[model samples]
Target: MIKTIIFDFGDVFINLDKHATEKELLKLGLPSITEDLEYINESYETGKITTIDFINYYQKLLPDVSEKKIIDAWNSILKDFPKHRLKFIQKLSENKTYLLILLSNTNELHIDWIKENVPFYNNFKSCFNFFYLSHEINLRKPNHDIFRFVLDNHQLNPVETLFIDDTFVNTNTAQELGINIWNNDPKKEDITNLFTIKSNLF
Candidate 1:
């Protein structure tokens, strides 16, 4: 019996063009997505660095690119939050059937953009018993520690928890810890169909 539900914010709830940032960066003369760049991104997501530092790092890498352009390129991955998904989660919350939690590997700028764009962000947040932003928590997913932290903090049994994420790596890590997972494919699957799609788990 899944008593708790953990959801990934990107793709799983709010839509995201996962490759948009890389594409935008390339247009801005990023050269290529190097290992160093990936490290910086992971650090930023885990709150290891400040927003200013993140922008500065990019600025140094691409001196000709303006700060505004860099910021825009970075946020290009975000997309609209569909109303139907919001309604489904809201209805699910109203039922109060499970301990709902949201865990997302997000940074400051992206969240600021979401706050400005997503009108029902507050209402959506209220639906979850716990809401954790990776930067705020200093923990990002696909990391065993983050999953373990959530399980330990809430006294949740991994066997009784279901984690839904669009990333295979994240779901794989969670599954290794004995947590049930739904590796949702954002392209082909809609989160609103969660019950019908993963009805066997319930």
Candidate 2:
């Protein structure tokens, strides 16, 4: 039986253009998505660097790109948070059937943008029994340690926990830790259909 539910914030809840950031960066004169750039992004997501340092790195690399422009480009990947999804989560929270947890691999800037843009951000956050953000926790998904931390922190049994994420890499890691997983495809899968789609697990 599933006693706890862990959800990913990105595609699973809010829609993301995943490629929008890269496209916007290209427009802002980023030559290509290099390994070094990926490293810097991951470092920022892991809270190894400050927001100023992140923007400074971009400024130094793309000298012509303004700080505001770089920030915009970086945040372009974020899109809308549909009301239906919020309602779904809200209903789930009201029922109080399972221990609801939100686990997201996100940086500070993106979160700040969400808080500013998403009108019901605080209400959505309150739906979760516990909310864990990567930068705030110094941990990101696809890392075994993060999965362990969540489980250990809640004293949750892996066999009775279900982790839903849009990323296969993250779900794969959670599965290895013996948790149930739904490696959802955002293009075709809507998280509101959780029970219908994965009924056998329940």
Candidate 3:
């Protein structure tokens, strides 16, 4: 029997852009996805850098871009959160048959947006016993170490864990570690209105 339910934050619960941020960044003449920006983002999330310092770094790199504009663009990936999914999660949590957990690779900027916009964010957090993030854990998905960290730290039985994520490589890696996985391809797999377990939830 499945003992734990693990969910990915971006696509599993909240809607995320397929490539909107990179597209918007590209429009800003930053074609290479700036190592500086990525570093500052990851670093900030891990507590290696402060939010103000990260903002300053971005400002230093893109002198012409306003701080507000850059921040807005950075958070633009958070487009929507379907209410039906929330209802489903609520229903599942109400059942209380499994240990509910969340594992997501997210940065500070996105989190700030969630705090500001999602009124149910606190309730969602309360529904899970464990909520892990790449930045906080200093490990990211698609990396075996992170998956191992989650499983070992939680004392989870791989066979009894079902991990849901939007990224194929992430799901692929978890599957390799013996955890049942679901690759939630939005174009092919619509989880927004899910109620019952389907053959292809994976």
At residue 38, candidate 1 shows an lDDT of 99
In the range 37-83, model 3's lDDT, one tens digit per residue, is: 67676677666776688778767767888888778777878888878
Per-residue alpha-carbon lDDT of candidate 2 for residues 1-202, written as tens digits (9 for 90 to 100): 9999999999998999999999999998888999999999999999999999999999988999789999999999999999999999999999999999999999999999999999999999999999999999999989999999999999999999999999989999999999999999999999999999999998
Candidate 1 C-alpha lDDT tens digits along 1-202: 8999999999988999999999999999989999999999999999999999999999998999999999999999999899999999999999999999999999999999999999999999999999999999999989999999999999999999999998899999999999999999998999889889989889
Cα distance off (Å), candidate 3, residue 23: 1.9
Instruction: Report lDDT (CA) for all predictions.
Output: 0.95, 0.96, 0.80
Clash totals for all candidate models: 0, 0, 0
> Using lDDT as the measure, what is the rank order of every candidate, best first?
2, 1, 3
Which residue pairs in candidate 2 collide?
none
- Candidate 3 is scored at a TM of 0.88
Ranked by TM-score from best down, the candidates are: 2, 1, 3
Best by lDDT: 2
- TM-score of candidate 1 on Cα atoms, chains taken together: 0.98
Q: Once superposed on the true structure, which residue ranges of model 2 sit more than 4 Å away at CA?
A: none
Report model 2's TM-score to 2 decimal places. Answer: 0.98
The CA lDDT at 35 in model 3 is 75
